[model samples]
Target: MSEHKDNAVAETVLVSSSSQPSQKVRQTAPVSAWNVLVQGIALFSDGYNVQIMGYMQTVMAKLYPKQLTSSIKTRLSNSILVGEVIGMLLFGLCIDRFGRRVGIIATTAFLVLGIILSTAAHGNTVTGMFWMMIVSRGVAGVGAGGEYAVCTAQALESADSSASLQKRRGFLVTISTNLAIVSGFVGSSIVSLIVIAAYGNKASEGIWRVCFGIGIFLPLTIFFVRMSLLDSSQYQKHAIQRRVPYMLAIRRYWRPLLGCSLAWFLYDFVVYPFNLLAPTLVSGFTKNPTLLQSVGWSALINSFAIPGAIFGGWLTDRIGRRQTYAVGWAIVCVLGFLIGGLRFPLRHVFPLFVVLYGFFQSFLSVGPGDCNFLVSSESFPTPLRGHFLGFAAAVGKAGSAVGTTVLTIALNSFQNQTKGQQVLFFIGSSISVLGTLVVIFMIPNHPATLEEEDSKFREYLEENGYDTSEMGLVEKH
Candidate 1:
């Protein structure tokens, strides 16, 4: 009887209540400022864990000299992507089925275990280290899979309650995404500085362990700190209502799922190349040590890339969703294509290219990463929201896995071979360009709020000649 009431409440909230002016005014009311800090800090941990490995190559190489062989090096480098694949699939299911709170706690536990295992990988035995490294990274990946979807969803949901307080929902929700990028930059900087300070000219074998140890520390800190916050009210309500099962989202909302999956897939195809493969790419291009200077340079470049995200968010509010997406994507296509193909012989020009690369890459990653959650969260009612997010994340991770594998293949095929980076540049840029076009044409350009989203989506389908009501209505399954 309670569940039915919960469902009725959810339907009312989704279909009509959210659109009312009173709700919007209430949404604008201030939330506890502390909540924002906790969410933002947790987001930093997410970015740190996801991208930390990129800067730890030298230390890892020293610790596991034997496994640093060509074949194994690529696998080790790409291991997080492999783990992320599993995390995306598993956590996606858990978040939808178990409740967002449960998924958050579960993913945090994974991060803790991942930290321990990653630390253990610095041990003397190669087999133990290899397997443990893989296992640990996979754990982190699981947490990452949970982090963006749940965190962004929760944040947006919270922001929604206070809607009249702030007109810019995109700006508010994107705080976590922006902070994550900043944290990633800071984490890489710390790792690089530690290596440089510890080793001076020649760092010892244990330095990578220190770096991983340091990387592990941030996420653990975040988990403990985050334990105090309440679960998203939206998610809590859904958990109470139990409106939809996970399987039904696949059967019912498959069109939005497909649209989201394709859009994210293409975005990830390019993003993983940089996020997972930047250090490796740098190693191939120059004879520089794969640590301090290279990572530092990338981090510095990324710092300048902040505007792309801020601008994307700002533009989304001013010009509308589709136009903002269209503008950013068009830049990505043009700038991305030019970044690789037009090579400069002068050594100094490489830094400029790196900055440009990071700028465009940041735009691509940040924009869609935010949109993925925003769109998925608003498209479904509270009951199936988690599942929709999880499904999209799972699909996105598959694309990430493919992108990482491609990077490894590209590296192996062109290792020490001349013009290898040029080829990669071409491939990466081309993917971004193509992805931009796909998003422009395929994705629904609707605001991701409960009141506006369903109506907008229905209208779009009617205009586009896709009859969703007959094929299968998106009911509370």
Candidate 2:
């Protein structure tokens, strides 16, 4: 047994040394600025659709008052997230097994169709319209969920394939992933302003339909652009021939999978409720805010997040993924505790509270908000990249669903709305504390490049007596 172990280790060393190429060959398709922009814009559609709904919810409750109770409104808000969880799981498998192109096209179609249905939803009864919108939003959520997986995977893998861009991969990928959310916030703000200006008092009845209608344009543009995209070259070279079975991939990489997924879960659970309910939270402080006022404030809050994301991306490249998250989460934890404890004193100057909340929220985009996807995209090998990313993302969406639903219920349970918000903030702060610990102890430090990580993985398999050739890996030599 000892001799066999020694021979296996020797063979692993020989294979690695022999396989080193004289020059690093581009193993993936050429990544262009156009490719990055298109993927980023495609991702923007998801954020626009998701964030727009938060603004629309205030109108929805009034328009369908007979049908939309507080409970039903919560369901409407959460429906899309629940659908997204399903979409991620399904499309993750599709992208991994068939191809990213297939996943992109199919998911976009679902998104477009769902948007159309939602825009046109009407019924004689409020109940009918309510269910129709709920179902339609859920369907749209599926497409958005799938987009999160494929778009992030494409951007990160494309960046990884280029040796020149390897050191900046975290920043590039983070920008591409996060820029969309900022765009969505800005877009939603603009639309809300337009609708409020156009209709004044009559905005509630029609503004939401217009917002959903606007969502169709970007996905339509993305569909046409996606037709021209080539599959990831790394996927073509490594995973195309011998696609790892999903179960096998899970069994092999459960550690990184759990780590990435839970980190995302904790991050989303804290952020989504705060963001999605921002308009409502703002309304609680100010009396009878107009649609523009609510969405405008929410957008202003989100605008601050853009710089944090940009900074976080650069910071990730500077200090490494783990340390960036630790710092960001620590800041959030401290702010969360302070704000939750001092809700009454801060209520007198609500704008100050908004700024403080926005600042802490921005730190999330800087830390876990950007890093979750970055770490998820980087930590896994190509064959199982989609599967792992999708699973982790789906888990994150599940956190969103819970955060929106359970947290809403918890907040409503308290007689005083301010106290309830305090409790919610306390919960979010506690989760961030846990997230900080998880980042330090669980996730491994990423390699400088994807190629290096893949090389080490192959070496591990060889040393463990796995047959590399049988797994369809070309010997690097």
* Candidate achieving the largest TM-score: 2
lDDT per residue, candidate 2, 1-477, as tens digits? 343222221212111111333323333323434566678888877888887887787677657666778767877888888889988999887887766777888899889988999899887887788788889999999998898888988788667655556667888788888767666766777776787678774546678888889999999976877766655555544453343444545666788889899999999898888887677666677798866677787888777778888899999999999889789888999989988998878888887898888888899888898898899888888656788899999998888877777778888899988888889889889999999988888888886666555555656666766555644233445
CA lDDT of each candidate?
A: 0.59, 0.77
Tens-place lDDT digits, model 1, residues 42-111: 7777666666666666556666577767666666656666666566667665665555556668877777
Give the worst 10-residue stretch by lDDT in candidate 2. Answer: 9-18
Model 2 lDDT at residue 303: 78
- What lDDT is reached at residue 45 by model 1? 75
Clashes of each: 7, 2
